[model samples]
Target: MDPSRSEFAIHEAAREGKAGVVDSLLNANPKLATQKDDDDRLPIHWAIANNHLDITSTLINTRNFDPDTPDGSGWTPLMIASSLKDNQGEQTVDLLLQKDVEVNAQSFNGQTALHFASSKDNLDIARKLIEHKASTRLKDKRGQLPLHRAAAVGSMPIVKLLLENKSPLNASDVDGMTALHHATSEGHGDAAVALLKAGAETDKRDMDGRLAIDTAPDAKVRKFILQSAEREGIEIVTS
Candidate 1:
């Protein structure tokens, strides 16, 4: 197979997990290994995006393969793996980390692997990224921290992990909404409780002057946050 004719074919093969085809294409022209498609994605990006571990491994081993190269959207292989929803994704992440890829590489949207892991509520992936030194405090384009993403998604375990790693508990976003506010607004009572326990300010308000308690999605959530504040000896005065 001519490498020029197989450009799209190679990417498709990787995406579909046809390792043999990818190998043939690479052997035909080693330069094909680093060629980008219209999406600015190499074979490796397609393989990682589709959770094709074997194909991903093959592509990463190719000479001059830029593992950290972002696609058209500025999403690195690590960032793509972090956003995956399967154990294969975790394995891909492990492989990338082993290769010493940038643990904290950001996308065009300024989202890190930790940000993606936290937002997706993938505790295992989040833990691995954290262990690899992925920053928990790095804010995205929205000025939202990983803690904010975890809280918004009601990821209590992730929230706890970030706190243990010294994530800023009361850090606010572009909206001036902290993790506590996100938890409350999303009706994540357990997340709210965890943030409060981690020293998130209950009285902290958003740009709208809405307190964390004020954003509670329901009465039950509001009551839970209020009770938690009472126990923390913090006053919950809403303006």
Candidate 2:
């Protein structure tokens, strides 16, 4: 294959977990190791994105391999790994973290790996990120903390982890909506219960001046919020 074709081939090999092909391509053109594809993604990004652990390792070992290099959308290998599921994703994350890549690196949207982990309900990944000192209080462009993302996605385990790590239960977003508001609005009764147990204020209002219970998607969620509020010595006032 031509040298230019080898460049594209390396990316394809990385994506397909073809470590031998990647090795040959890099050997043919050493600079291909750091070359960016059309999407501005290096071979490392492709390897990690596809959960090709061996290929990822080979790419990371290359000279000048920047694990924190952002793709066209400003997504780092860490961020991409966080968005994956299962043990492969976890292993990829561990590899990146071990390289001392920026654990709190944000994407174009200002979303950190913790934000992705929380939104995806990857409890173990979230725990690892927290252990690495990923700030739970950090917000995205929308001013949403990891806890807010977890609540919006109905990730009860993630919500619990964030709260245990001192994430503010009542932390509001740009819309002035807390995790409780997201939980109730999404009709996640279990998530709402978790937020309430963590002391999320039910009376807190969003930009629309609507409380969490007011946004409850159904009677079941409303009833749960009201009952939980009562247990916290708060009254639910309905007009």
Q: Give me the runs in candidate 1 sitting further than 4 Å from their true place.
A: 1-7, 228-234
Which candidate leads in lDDT?
1
For model 2, the superposed segments whose C-alpha errors exceed 4 Å read 1-7, 228-234, 237-239
lDDT of 2 by residue, 38-140 (tens): 9998888888888889998888788887879999999999888898865348888888888888998899999999998888888888889899999998889
CA displacement after TM-score superposition, residue 118 of candidate 1 (Å): 0.5
Q: Worst lDDT window (10 residues) for model 2?
A: 1-10
Q: Model 1 reaches what TM-score against the true structure?
A: 0.93
Q: What is the number of backbone collisions in each predicted candidate, taken in the order shown?
A: 0, 0
- Could you tell me the TM-score of candidate 2? 0.92
Query: Over the stretch 1-239, how does candidate 1's per-residue lDDT look in tens digits?
Result: 76436548888888888888888888988898888898888889999888888888888888886668999999999988988874458988888888888988888889998998888888899999999888887888999999999999999999999999988889889999999899889999888887777777766789999988888778887888778778877676666
